[model samples]
Target: MSILGVDYGAKKIGIAKADPTGGPAVPLTTLIVANQKEGIERLQQLIASEGVELLVVGVPVSLSQSGAELLRDKDHLNKQMQEVLQFVERLKNTVTIPVELEDERLSTKLANGMQKELVKINGDDAVAAMVILQSYLDRKKL
Candidate 1:
């Protein structure tokens, strides 16, 4: 199965792809859009072009507290996550393929760490999608 992972954001969307054979998820491209409509359009084009059979979207949820700062940010984070779910709902409506939301806590941070360790590449939203997709793929293997 061809799976596409998406990291959704207000201004940009990150894309990554992997196959059922358990290959490494690769970062595709970042779509920058003015709004949700434009984002959906671009995403549809990507799904068509990439032959995606399933879509995995990253959802930021407050599942852990590593420090005191998290308590302060919890309310704001919850509100932001609600907006993300709204965007995910709209995206699901635009595609016929099955779409699933995976917990994406610390995906960006992990991507940043990976980028720093691997040198020679700049950081972008796509890296975060890679992290999300790879996590999903790994879980499926078990």
Candidate 2:
């Protein structure tokens, strides 16, 4: 199905576009997901504009790491990012299309590390959307 991938965040929501053929997801513009109402309007506009049949949102899940360095998750960070998921959850009821959530632990980091022409987009909403969309694509592969 044609879909819009969203990197849900408090300040901004990253977005990506993909068709049902299972191809590379292209980065679209980012949305300023301000609050509950604003988030809904933006998402609705995006869905209509892109003719999206499905929506994929990123969920930030932090881990305790259990005495290991790898377990040290940015709890505060994810807590703040929780607003994104809240928006997505709320949208689940209002929208006609299906919504999917994927783990977005390292998408921001990946966005920050982009190089070359993408260097300008590093740490921006577009890169974040790429991470979200790519994760969705990878998951569907398995």
Model 2: residue 56 alpha-carbon error in angstroms: 0.8
Q: What TM-score, computed on C-alpha atoms, does each candidate reach?
A: 0.82, 0.78
For candidate 1, lDDT tens digit of each residue in 18-132? 9867679888888889998898899888888888899988877633323234334545666667667777778878899988767788988888778563322534588899899
Per-residue lDDT of candidate 2, residues 11-84 (tens digit)? 77777888867777777887775577787788898888878998877766632223122123324445555466
Per-prediction tally of clashes: 0, 1
Off by over 4 Å in 1: 62-77, 117-122
- Residue 120, candidate 2: Cα error in Å is 1.9
Which of the numbered candidates is closest to the native, going by highest lDDT? 1
**Prediction RMSDs, each to the true structure:** 5.7, 5.7
List pairs with backbone clashes in candidate 2. Answer: 65-71
C-alpha lDDT (0 to 100) for residue 7 of candidate 1: 89
User: Each prediction's Cα lDDT score?
Assistant: 0.78, 0.71
